[model samples]
Target: MIPASSGTGLPVAVNGIEIEVIRRGAGRPLLFLHPGIGIAPEAPVLDYLAEGVEVIAPSHPGFGHSQLPATMTHIDDLAYFYLDFLETFDLREVIVVGVSFGAWIAAEVAVKSTERISRLVLADAVGVKIGDRTSRDIADIFAMTDTQFAEMAYHDPRVGQRDTTALSEAELLTMARNREATARFGWIPYMHDPKLKDRLHRVRVPTLVLWGESDRIVTPKYGRAFCDALPDARFELIELAGHFPHIEQPETFARRVLSFAGEAGVPVTAVKRASA
Candidate 1:
């Protein structure tokens, strides 16, 4: 494992679309796909992950400053774009870590091709349809009040609290942009791809399904099904956390990830925590 370091932030153009990317640490490449709400450069999960390996966290198009192509309208489009991204950067045997909506994208990319990725970790992922008619595959964050969503999304409510008065104009606008992108890709299918479940077998990479035991958004049962569908996957549960376990419990989450990858022949360090 390499010594600890922060990400080197920059923007790179991929097939005419400019995507914001942060690359840091020095070891094997570990690509981080951000959640639907987007990525804050200082997010602790990235920092912790970087402590152990080279971390590449890129903002999906339309999420941050990344430009969205006119033809890209669905999550699968993002998947294909990322596949191109992998090839463009010539990344091989990369370890992909994703959370919530981001996890969905990772799964999409893996199902399509694992030529670049060796292993994957999906935490509180929102994709695939396995719920019954009465139970929703994923919660409706759009319809919930801020308080309601916060209570459901985090184990500690304070973590989810956002003081609007402290926000800058740019931050507020970015939040709006994040919401818009999420709606375009996730809202219609309610955060899932109807056909994705059946296609999971195509994922040849070993996967780790991490779930927040306290998550009210997507149950562990759903997580189990997700693991089962994959050709090779195992499930791990994080206590004292909700949907975003990596944020709620960075130390435990990072250690779990690092340990999993290490056992699979990838060397990544798991040190003390930060904010994701």
Candidate 2:
């Protein structure tokens, strides 16, 4: 296992799988699960969150420097893997925050147990089946070209653009690994778990469903449906954003989360600002 680094990340063995995790800060313990695109060492949202809480952001196995166990082939395996993580770390009352594909895994984890989780936040999440068999709730990201995906994924497509030529070989390889891992789990079912919708009721903790106001990948309408399925949940939208609100509106996103978590110094006005 790799030694712990202060702000970057570390390789820690969980269930015999070495997963790279970024951990920092000190108030409340918050477990952040990244989107299918994976988490960068300098993701602004993580910095925002870490400023207020102890943010534990892990690169899902197979998505970064993490070791993917050959036996772990399904998202359910991920759900279970996280449960073990919480237990291993002795973390409790964690504010579990997930975005996009990560939110899907958070939902799965919540369905099984809320014993360790206090509040749940799912931002632009895609995992449940809320429509008929003939309907498509999520965009077919795998089939879209890079340009098409960027257009669909961001309100301002330019925000999603990357100068690949500027990236180091390691950065490029991590991006490729993230794509392969996303397709490995989500491709077969086209992103939704058929049984997940029915099990959402099992999530007893209060949930905050944050969606991008302009997300074409999984429209706000779909996000509302996801919220409605939860017993104790409220829906909020981040303006001028698309599929990844955490990236597009990190300040607002972080403010809303801190408000929801009732973090000690966060002003009550933050809630009003977030809604504004």
Candidate 3:
């Protein structure tokens, strides 16, 4: 297991699978779970959050440098893997922040784990069925041009254009593999657990639903429904942003998250503004 540079890294073993976990900063443990499909656990969003509080980001097995088991098939399998993961790490009173597909996993983990999870932040999260509106399919996305893929992934079209040309062939292939894995788990009807909306009442933890105001992928309406379903939750929209708001508006995104973490008694400092 490679050590996470920000602090002493912890090699966590769960369900016979070893995950690389990086812990940085101090105070309450805030676990950041990356979205599926080409994202490593150490995504830039996690790095942005790390500046304020202790952040634990783990690479999902089979993605990045982590080990992948041959028998895994469903997203629920990943859910259980993380439940065991939290127990192995002895992380209690945790605050989980998940983006996109990771948000779905975070919700699953919160419901299944008996531990004390203080709050949950779902940013442009999936895992629920909306009436008449279908989530994007993996197969369709794969067929699109790189520009199309970028446009769908980001709110600002320029971000997509800027990054597409620089992506190496290896990166592109990894993205394809991740998409295939996601399809195996989330491509069925609804692309999410049908009962998840009903189960929101059982979550018990305070929840924050964040969305990109201009996100065409998931739609802002879905974000509101997710927030409304949770008993103790609030929704916020990041202006001029798309699906991945944290990347598009890092400063605002991080500030809002840090504020939420603080409200949950997680002891995170407010993000400091830089001088002009």
Candidate 4:
């Protein structure tokens, strides 16, 4: 059991799986959904957001320390599960923030849930399948060198540090399992929903599509497509960053996210104070 940090730990059953959730800070709730692979909401990128608003970051059923179901399949299940999660917590008027695969789930939640979401921030998100453009396949990504992985996953090379050679066997196995599970959900054709782009028009909430200008993995073109689909959305590109700009450029990331959160009516501090 990973001990709770700032947010209290709560277990909620979704589709028979008990999902571990961490709630931190105070004020309007902002649900943070993490990307697949080694990324977790507890990562530094998300930790910065916790300082401003009440943040709720849940480990997807098959990632992090969360329980993985024996027969879980497809990303849609995750979307439905999160809808139930919000209902279970009686969370209304929420601001949804999702990164990478988490952003896909957030989009699904926005579409499927009956509850109202005030705003959405999809950063380096993948959900809609665009024609002609090829997305980074999971199998291909795993075969890349650490430096190559960094180049594909981040616009900035600094966020690509990995020293897994010293990891224990158990830790390595766990990582493998997480990757396998992620593939199961995210490996569909085009790495996105073929119909999702058309469905974006249905979402009534204000949306902000954030992208790393140097993101070669998903490409910034897709980001513009995502922004174009939303009825009330705009796109912003983070310079000197890559796929995971939030991590590579935390201060800039936090400022932009907080600015969007503020516009979405999430009560929080003014601009984030720069580090000394």
Candidate 5:
């Protein structure tokens, strides 16, 4: 059974598995696919987006406290699950925002069907093979020590510096589960879907390939190539941020995302401040 903490999102069964989802604000629905670290709507980026557009944040099965079913092991499966989610909820002309691994999921979802997604944003997304075969594709999150991962993932390493002594057993378990799920879906492909680049050309939705200029996990160069593959996409870079610009610079990230999503007038300052 998934731990009670997964209750952060209302439970909804999809693809023969129960998915934890939380909705915030009230307006046109905006589906937010969070990073592998899991969805916690309290994050400032969600709040800011919520101020203007309804934000639907869900914990991917196997991450956070969400139920991990035996059948769901690949990223492609997740893309299908979210496709069902959109249909189940009857959401239309939706805006989908995804970051990091979540961005990869969003890409997979977009390529399969943009029927529900009108505006798509992939922030420092990883999931396409690009550049010379000899070049490093993506930094292995599994290989990096926690500290090292944070250093490469965040422009300010201290943002992820943890005081292990302070965490309860439940907190530790949640962290472990998040890591396990990441490895389960992302390890074998080592992050890129060999065919995703080709499928991207079929996506007709307005797309923004947003990247943290300092991202070490997947560099901006890769992001540009990812953008170039899409028929209707533009690449935008965020400064002073690494892999997770939404965490390091919420205001700037929100501004860029909102602008692209057609909510540029939304006052970013009013939303409660939080993190990824």
Candidate 6:
């Protein structure tokens, strides 16, 4: 059955899958890939980015109001779907931005082809294994309680809190669907793709890797290693923030992103700064 629109976005059929996309502003095109938990179309970061450039934020298939085809089950499948999305839209010289699990998808897409993409941004990404088999690089989100996840995922746990009692049935169902989809794509390998590390070199575009200072999910050290693997990439930290810096510091996150993408609409220096 076709689902209703997620209120803030429209559903577009891409490769036979109905994907919910939140499009805002106008100018340079920027594709915003969301985290594992899915995207809230009303996210402030999207508004901030839209001030300078067009922001197209799409909920991954199986998340939000999007459809999940039976054949799509891996992160690589998402990567290819995005490639097709770019082609279908005839988008060119686009800036691709991704957060957390979405960053992994962005990386996979960039490695495969950069024909449609111009610059890339990854924030608190987790898709490559940098340690020995016994070492745990990413925190086990599956095992953590809601409180524990909030404590680990945000510098201020209050910012990540959602009152389940206040949410509608649809909202609750979407949340569950997102979690299930996340596991389907990431469970077997425990997050990291075995071959993705070796293919990092294929992402030739200039890239920016942003990490939250207080993130326990994946430390800044791990972020640096992820950046180092790329041919040309720089690492920066968002102060007083955790896994989802975009949520914790929207203005700062947008400034860094716009600055890196060379957007003239939003004028802000891009450098290492404390307290944003």
lDDT for model 5 comes to: 0.81
**Residue 96, model 3, lDDT:** 88
Q: Distance from true position, residue 95, model 2, in Å? A: 0.4
Best by lDDT: 2
Q: Please identify model 1 stretches exceeding 4 Å from their true place.
A: 1-8, 265-276
lDDT of each: 0.85, 0.88, 0.72, 0.73, 0.81, 0.88
| lDDT per residue (tens digit) for residues 1-276 in model 5 | 122332257777775677778777777778888887876656888777777787788889888767877888899988998898888768898899999899999999988888877888999999888866877689888888889988888878898788877999988888889889988999887887877877776676778889998888899988988887777678999999999888888888878887888833222123211111
Candidate 2 lDDT, 1-276, residue by residue in tens: 224568687889897899899987778889999999998878888889888898899999999999998888889999999999999988998999999999999999999998898899999999998788889999999888888999999999999988888999999999999999998889979897888888887887888999999999999999998998887789999999999999999989999998988843221121111110
Better by lDDT, candidate 6 or 4: 6
Better of 1 and 2 by TM-score: 2
Winner by TM-score between candidate 5 and candidate 3: 5
In candidate 4, what are the lDDT values of residues 119-209, reduced to their tens digit?
8899888887664555342225656787888778876676676678988886687677778877788665535776666666566677789
Order of candidate numbers by lDDT, starting with the best: 2, 6, 1, 5, 4, 3
What are the models' TM-scores? 0.92, 0.93, 0.83, 0.85, 0.90, 0.92
What are the RMSDs of all candidates, in order?
6.7, 5.5, 7.5, 7.2, 7.5, 6.0
Off by over 4 Å in 6: 1-7, 263-276
Q: Pick the candidate with the highest TM-score.
A: 2
Candidate 2: residue 11 lDDT (0-100): 87
Candidate 5 Cα errors over 4 Å, as ranges = 1-7, 263-276
Model 5: what TM-score? 0.90
Q: Which tens-of-lDDT digit does each residue in 15-85 have in candidate 1?
A: 77888888777688898898988888877877788778888888999988888887888999999999988
Root mean square deviation (Cα) for candidate 1: 6.7
Regions of model 3 farther than 4 Å from truth:
1-11, 38-44, 133-143, 162-166, 264-276
